[model samples]
Target: MNQDPLQNLRLSHPAHFLALGFGSGLSPVAPGTMGTLVTLPLVWLLAFSGQTGYLLVTLLACVAGVWICGRTARDMGVHDHGAIVWDEVAGMLLTMIAVPVNWLTLLVGFLLFRMLDIFKPWPISYLDKHVHGGAGIMADDILAGVVACGLLHLLIFIGWLPVPAL
Candidate 1:
């Protein structure tokens, strides 16, 4: 525990500026997952506004998160360290894309996102291990979100999953 997470992860690097995710990576507990979880309130609140707001925010995060995550990672000198989790936040937000504003849908989306993220299958795993800097850390999670979102969308399209009441 004496090894500071920031020091060990090297979050001070200038290039990884965005990877720090506004310092969300500094959280004590499972920083990455927690950082991702931190967005739940905002996501839930915006859910009522329809998918447009959520979509807009998620998209914005995705675009911005890349730079943030990349900068922070470079500054820290760590390659895709767990502390850098803005990718998870963006990915989770992406997973919820098009999802109706409801507890059930949110819960399902969260589960799916977490599951896919943890698994990091196929392209996600490849990018996670192969890519470098902020793109490495965030890209894989974002891809995971894409996969989860596609699955969710497919379920909805086929009538397997009903849209929740907003």
Candidate 2:
């Protein structure tokens, strides 16, 4: 008899719960996207805390995610399993840093982050290939977020993407 692959990954486990993006990573399709979407509310909430607070929290999450993701992956006996999406959560948070919290900014940030993450351009692709372990799983997405953040900022600076008055 074959057991379900997810059977061993219990949501009851704190590491599993976090690493899986609070169950968003369990989605049957586009788990990474789902994980990123799940983090939107968090980004919205963090917006109120200002950029410094947002950066601190995102940094903490990324640091903790290394351990949370690594431990969960070890338990599941896989290397950077598709269902481990804490990296996505941290990446999305990084992408939204200092950007306005309005819907347009949120949507643009989401698309930019997701696009870079999916496409893995240049250095992002390099890190994805050369890096290993939990840090490896996270480095690429974080870089994608950084690049996306820069692009978004550029758009705002150029007046291509106007920052709506809050």
Report every candidate's CA lDDT. 0.74, 0.91
Worst 10 residues of 1 by lDDT: 8-17
TM-score of 1: 0.79
Model 1 clashing-pair count: 20
- Which ten-residue region of model 2 has the weakest summed lDDT? 1-10
lDDT string, candidate 2, 42-129, tens digits: 9999999988999999999889988898888888878788899999999999898888888988999999999999999999999999
lDDT of 1 by residue, 12-117 (tens): 5543434555567677777777766776777788777777777888888888777777766565555666777788788878887777656666677777888888
Q: What is the lDDT of candidate 2?
A: 0.91
